[model samples]
Each structure stands twice: as C-alpha cells, then as structure tokens.
Target: MNTNYHYMRFLVSPKTADALSLRQAIQNALVQTFGIVGGSIYLDILWVAEDGNEMVLRTTKEDSTKIVAAVTSASTPRISLQKESSFLPALGSTSVTLDEEDL
Candidate 1:
C-alpha cells in the first residue's frame, strides 16, 4: 500500500438563514488559502436541501493542516464547522466517525 491519502468532508451550520452564501464564503476561503499549494487539490461545496442555510463540504487535500487552518480562521460568527475528518489512504481509511465527544 502506498499509504498516501487525501480527502475531507464536513458540515457547516451558520447562525444565519443563508446557507448557500455561507458555503460559498467558506469555499472561497479554501481556494484563496490553498490555491497556492503545489499538489493538485479539489474542493466541493454542497448546500443542504437548497434551504441556503445548511451545507456540507468535501475537500481533497494536498495538505490537511493548511486546509484546517484556513477553514478555522475563515469561520465567522454566522458560520461554524459542524463536523470534519482527515483521511489517509495509505492506511486504508474507511469512514469518518462523528462522536458525541467531538462537540
């Protein structure tokens, strides 16, 4: 096994009624922050149920630390990370466990 991996998926719940906008803001932050990284990376933002108030994000990382730092810093009073995970393919990753203790 190469033991190399990259992928992250998380949910964001904003305090406001505009989920889609919140998602866009976060996506912009990620791209702006990580676009300079050398390795090819990908980001996907999904708005929950078209309500424009809840969303999920999937990111393929060249570096998890950078992504985490960017997201954490970009988060605002109206937006917060609900759940997230870092994957390592070299370890044969499977699923992300969102534990009660995570909160």
Candidate 2:
C-alpha cells in the first residue's frame, strides 16, 4: 500500500521523563480513541525537542486527524496538537514556541 505521511507538532505540558513514555501515551490515547489496529499502526514520533515540551510526529495522512483528536483528549499530561503540515512546512518555520496557556 502507498501511504503519505505528514508531520504534526504538539505542545506538551509537564514534560515527560523520556520519549518512550511519551510515545506510549500517545499510542494509548490513539488506541482508546481509534481502536487497537488503527491506533498502533500508523503513528511514529519523529523527534522530541531537547526541552521535552515539543514533539514532532509522523503519521499517515488518513490517520492524522484521529491522532490529533486522541492527543487533545488526553488529560493527564495535557497535549495540544499544534499544526498539521507536510514535513517541509512543519520544519520551515524558524521559531515555534508553546504558550504558557497551551501547557
């Protein structure tokens, strides 16, 4: 199958200790929202910012919206799905900062 993956940036609150937990939370949220197969298959965390407050995720275009909704509904860590765009567009912006309220 041919899949087109896009990148999404999220502003995370109360930074997690490591990427593994972050990824797991996201996947768990996805599974809860979208079901086991859909949630576990298409998402991957491409990069986690040094501060751990930001994460760039790559997911199939078809699954993007579901992933965003899943993340937004997760309350414990409070995640905000910042933007959805192609890889280059997501990387093109020079300064991407999370506001205090977003956290």
What RMSD, rounded to one decimal, does every model reach?
7.6, 6.4
The lDDT per prediction is 0.51, 0.79
lDDT of prediction 1: 0.51
Candidate 1: regions farther than 4 A off: 1-13, 16-20, 31-41, 47-53, 75-78, 85-103
Report the Cα lDDT for residue 22, model 2: 89
Q: Which candidate is the best by TM-score?
A: 2
For candidate 2, write residues 80-100 as lDDT tens digits.
977778663645476769999
Highest lDDT: give the candidate number: 2
Scored against the true structure, residue 67 in model 2 reaches a CA lDDT of 79
Clashes of 2: 0
lDDT of 1 by residue, 4-88 (tens): 4344443454444464565466666666666745323455553343544444545544555565666676746234444445532
